[model samples]
Target chain A: MTQNPQITPEWIAVDCSATQMRATAMGAAGPLAQATGETSKDLEAALLCLIAPWLSAQTTPVIACGWDAAPFRAVPCMPADAATLVDIPTEDARISLRIAPGLSQTNPADMMCGEETVIAGALALNPDFDGVICLPGLHSRWVHVSAKEVVSFQTFLTGELFSLLSQPDDTLDGFDPTAFEAALSETLSRPEKLGAKLFSLRAEVALMGLSPRAARSGLVGLLIGTELAAAKPYWLGQPIILIGAPGQCDHYAHALRQQGITPATLDAGDCALAGLSKLRGLL
Target chain B: MTQNPQITPEWIAVDCSATQMRATAMGAAGPLAQATGETSKDLEAALLCLIAPWLSAQTTPVIACGWDAAPFRAVPCMPADAATLVDIPTEDARISLRIAPGLSQTNPADMMCGEETVIAGALALNPDFDGVICLPGLHSRWVHVSAKEVVSFQTFLTGELFSLLSQPDDTLDGFDPTAFEAALSETLSRPEKLGAKLFSLRAEVALMGLSPRAARSGLVGLLIGTELAAAKPYWLGQPIILIGAPGQCDHYAHALRQQGITPATLDAGDCALAGLSKLRGLL
Candidate 1:
């Protein structure tokens, strides 16, 4: 059957975080182009600048997601479950802008914006996949997916804390896997000591003159350790799928391997595109 | 017991933190004058300006403590146990500045500068007392004191974390004891979940429209709960004394009371003065 030109897959998927924005242009088979820019004071203007080259004469559907997206429409706690898409009014007539609603958990009162689309894509790819999917980023998500639905999830501030602590002059220079493992074990055994443990990093550097790499690795280990300890219910003996930037996924993968669990990894950008494509197919 | 005129009543006690400096003029009876200033680019100049009026024609001994104090001289782990005082050389002939050394633990590798003097003063006042002294500040310390010595100590970044999280625009309004208590209980029960629990604060505010007061109290509760869980070894069955600013002390007191403990409190400034006075007697 001949396809309708209007619905032949001219679309753009945008993830706009508080600081940065990424857009992927989708053609018939796959992504045509990918662009990123700072999410400036005017998000639309910045987003237009990034995806301007990908625009066509046809009305191209723009699906945006992230914390910076307009107020989220509460969706059911299920993976790959599409929520009502709200239209984002734009000055450009060629653009049909719409934002995907985020996921929310009422009991713990947790929420995820951009990751929901990624989760949708993952679930769509593996319909029978079960267990936890960890999306590591500024706000890391540890989501429980059972029978292709997101039952519940938790968000950790591990990435944000690490970024804040290592900003400007506090950058850690070296990488020490041993130090990271040791710190991970320490935190896992005594998670309550995390508050004191965090400060000890600074003291160690100041007094003991600890190597920058050791400090950095130890910090990552401590944060990930605490997260694992808390997310034990979600990952203990269960398969975990790691999704995020390659560097972050590698860090998580290493951390998990140290704990005797080897998690599967996926690229976050690819996942976002796949998720958006899957959603478009549903539409 | 005739007093030597040269060594008579003139003395200054200064506490120099990373951001600010406070000085008190000590007379025969009590503190005669108090001054404070920003810890500027030139610490010596800033310190001089703070205590210039209190300086005597005869070189007045200025006992200094805090993070800005000279590198600490290692001392025995005993309450009120003195360390070698390091003289801070200055251009001014009138200033005879000597900095008190802070306590350091080798095992966990922790250090404290100004709080050591307060612990000293606390020990001086209660020679027979032996217990945990909680000094709450930017870097809160839970020090175990036994037999007039600082046996060991742990430092928590609770205050610092709270300050950082509440800055710019996220200041929590009002006070909610119930919320604080609830959060404390949650964190104490599952301290490992703290990393995830922290981000939930922001999410709750965004998704659930949680009150600022509740959020503030919850943050305090979560931090203190985790601290209390780790510090159980120090304060579980032991008598506790708090030395810090009244507000911080009160918060610690309330948090402790929730755990079925009534802690005695001493003013940190007064403790510093008393500790310096006791040290002066030794000199």
Candidate 2:
């Protein structure tokens, strides 16, 4: 049998956000040929400049584009609205571009935000993952991906809520995060009087004059406990995979393990890169 | 025999929320003419109807405008700032008024909410009250009233927080509230292992197929515990006066008593009304 000829494909990955845009170029072998990132409020200019460098490298047939966020892209339509690709301009600035369908939920019409793409990308790296995936930060997302698709997800207002609760205003402020982390660790160990401990924030202030930091720590503990309560039903008996900040992941992992749930975390960027690489051909 | 002339003062009580206005014609001997009440959203209109009959009957200066919400009476220098009034129009259309402010802080900028009216009202009934007054609800307010003025207060998003944590959208729909209340009562009986019980929402769903209602109840317990933690600082071994829902007050009373804080609950409306009545002259 004659061996099939090798074909090099030009590809681009556009990761868009409210504040910035990141774009990457990849070869057929999934290696980054060139990368561009820009911080701008306007995504249109960012996207145009992001893919401009890759166009001159090689004029390959059927250029593939891996796009995320609300940035525009085009592809051919398939049956039942699946893979329904639209048209893209074939100008020098606007070459071939493709968009992958991020996780979409109807009924309420809620969709994941920027960080979720990275999370979805992470899950794409491990197709066999069958558990809870926690993306921790100010606005943490817990996405459930199974059987080649994102099944359901929930967002915990952990970071922002903590900020608001800890710092009611300028006069009031938060204490060291270590105190919060320590309280979290201790609360997880017992996991019994967690609520009582949470309620103690105001009590501590009233009784012991808990500084803004301590009050903030108390709030952090309470929010974490509340989030755990919310996530329990969805993640019961399932292993947890965390992405995002290392310290936050460690805290959550410690908390989860104390509660007898297995937890594992990986770097967010690596997952996105791996996911973008694998989907290069399709893009 | 010589006797000081008895002075009866005319009084008006305005409940903006309920859209009810009341006026009592008085003399030094106490209420001389009939007191009247009318239902109206317009404060001026309601007041006219309530006091018009009394005004026609006799000529007496309106000693004071006792109103619950700040909008009922407009005094230029009394409050100094309208923004400082704690109780205002609620979201509900049916309730046409807000809670009024009691005493002002020396800081000028420092002022408490209308719930201060309740504490004042409670004190009007029990002037020697020296403890924590917990106004539990969606926006739980904890006030430490000392020497007839509110010394300190804090707000807790306990009820709203609980709803967000347990119910979380329409996912846990069609939940029976009765069963949840029972479970909540059971949880309240033993405050030692509340954290475990709080987390048990997920456990129950997994192990026993807990219904949405049961999960909601678990959330309430968690909120109570969290609220307790926040209020603990201000407790200062003072008695807890629950000024909201009777059932909730009883639950909190039981919880606080277990934690070694004495608790007493009064009629929520009575406190609100009395608070409004006491502030009638100021408004």
- Residue B143's lDDT in candidate 2: 72
lDDT of 1 by residue, A124-143 (tens): 77677888899999888999
Clash count, predicted structure 1: 6
Q: Candidate 2's residue-wise lDDT over A1-283, tens digit each?
A: 1222242236565655444455655565565544456556544455656555445545432222233433221111110122433334445443555444444333212344444446556666676777668877766667676654556666655665555445455464334656666666554443434434444555565445567666665566555655675567656787678887676676577567656777778986666555555455343
Q: How accurate is candidate 2 locally (lDDT)?
A: 0.53
| All candidates: CA RMSD (Å) | 4.5, 13.3
Best by DockQ: 1
How much lDDT does candidate 1 score?
A: 0.80
List lDDT for all candidates, in order: 0.80, 0.53
Candidate 1 local lDDT, residue B259? 87
